[model samples]
Target: MQDVRAGLISAFHWRSDPPVWPEHRIYYADDSAWWREPTILGELGSSLAALFSDEPPTVVMSPESRGSLLGPLVATHLGIGFAEVRKGAERASDDEVWLRRRTPPDYRDRHLEMAVRRSVLRTGDRVLFVDDWAATGAQAMACQQLAGDAGASWVGAAVIVDGLENSADRRLLMLRSLLHLRDLRRR
Candidate 1:
């Protein structure tokens, strides 16, 4: 995990003027490069897999965009199915369900809607939510709600970076990350 964290830290870039939110000055870590490389993705998947080894998930869910990339890789490594929660105006079929939540203006500062197909997630299924990063944990909370609505249980969350100050207060789900906000900020 330390090696993975080091790699991520070295690869990550920080900027004050983020495209989505320019007012806030913070350490921004771009995960696109890591997602594109198979070896890096595999290593990330392996680390997350080890974190969730004790509690294997039946299904892995991720929010659209970055989550879409990491979720599938982790799910594939764990031999589980991957489900995506669409953001924005994406529509789901009649059988699909949508879960919406309001996120703090930390990153995008907007309302986000996540959807999952009813057929893909079953009741009593253990789900692990995956994402590239978590700042305020608004998105992860929304994902947890989506899982609950689908009658699935949230096992935990796995991410490359954990930026939440009060991770325990976010929810009952355990969170595992390779790097943290402080780690990046210190750099």
Candidate 2:
């Protein structure tokens, strides 16, 4: 993960001309935190599928953020079910599955909020988390907390890129970006 994080910081740029953002505000709250390249996203999805090829995952819990788009692609490639974590809404008593989200200070929401949705994970269930990028691990940890609360076993996080130094290093089962600073600097 350390190598992956260094590669991400060196290769990717947050500021791009003409700006590519999603129609939904939740995904791209700010230009600083989203991955907009379609090719990269596709590659990331494929990479995620490859990681689990040995024992292909069965269910994927995607963050309600930008990663949702890529998560489905990965899930489809792996032939699994995809569950989204939606923010600012309450699910029915039976439907409610609580997940914590540690939003960065600049996040549009301006505060931490828990995403609630229909429970897709049952006690002792194995689940994977998919996200576009990871900077501080807050979001990932939050998801872990939610998964723990729901009695689901956390498989790990798969991301397009991770900027935090050593963020993914030593993580038992995480997959990250293929490009590093050297790769991005040339592009």
Candidate 3:
């Protein structure tokens, strides 16, 4: 765990410039370094999965972006299956049914609709949401709603960097993270 934490911190990079970010300087993260490191890659799954060792989920679910990367690792560590949560219900027809929910405004204040296939998340399955980061937890809220719709119990979320601005969201998501956003902030 110590090695993983050190590896994660050393691998992280943030970018902020006057020309690019004048007043509102949001974190421009470059997290590709750790992805290439063999040791970090090997430890990520086990470290993140250890966060919820006691109450392990039946299935791990994550959004299709970066979450897809970490979710599988946690699932593999826990010896459980992983479900990919898709963003948006782009194609709607009589073909397949999806459990969907519109998220509240995120860090960028953009509302997005996240979805998961009904078949992937079965009824009565315990779901653990794993992701790379959580800024506003809008996506986590949507995930919780989708889990409810599927009749699956939500076991909470595990993330690498938790930057949540609201204490309510922190509690609501039951967020556990390896590093707080403040740990990486410019000091």
Task: Tell me how many clashing residue pairs each candidate has.
Answer: 0, 5, 0
What Cα-based lDDT does every candidate model obtain?
0.76, 0.58, 0.88
lDDT digits (tens) for residues 54-123 of candidate 1: 8989999988888887888789899989988776635445654555444444466776665676667779
What CA RMSD would candidate 3 show? 1.9
lDDT of 2 by residue, 89-154 (tens): 565676445655554432233555546353665667667778765656556666666677777777
lDDT over C-alpha atoms for residue 61 of model 2: 75
Q: Which residue pairs show collisions in model 2?
A: 1-168, 1-169, 7-180, 10-181, 11-181
Backbone clashes counted, model 1: 0
**Which portions of model 2 show Cα errors greater than 4 Å?**
1-44, 92-111, 166-175, 180-183
TM-score of 2: 0.64
Once fitted onto the true fold, the runs of candidate 1 whose alpha carbons sit more than 4 angstroms away are 17-27, 36-38, 92-106
> How should the candidates be ordered by lDDT, best one leading?
3, 1, 2
TM-score, cand. 3: 0.92
Compared with the true structure, model 1 gives a TM-score of 0.83
- Candidates sorted on TM-score, descending: 3, 1, 2
CA displacement after TM-score superposition, residue 17 of candidate 2 (Å): 9.6
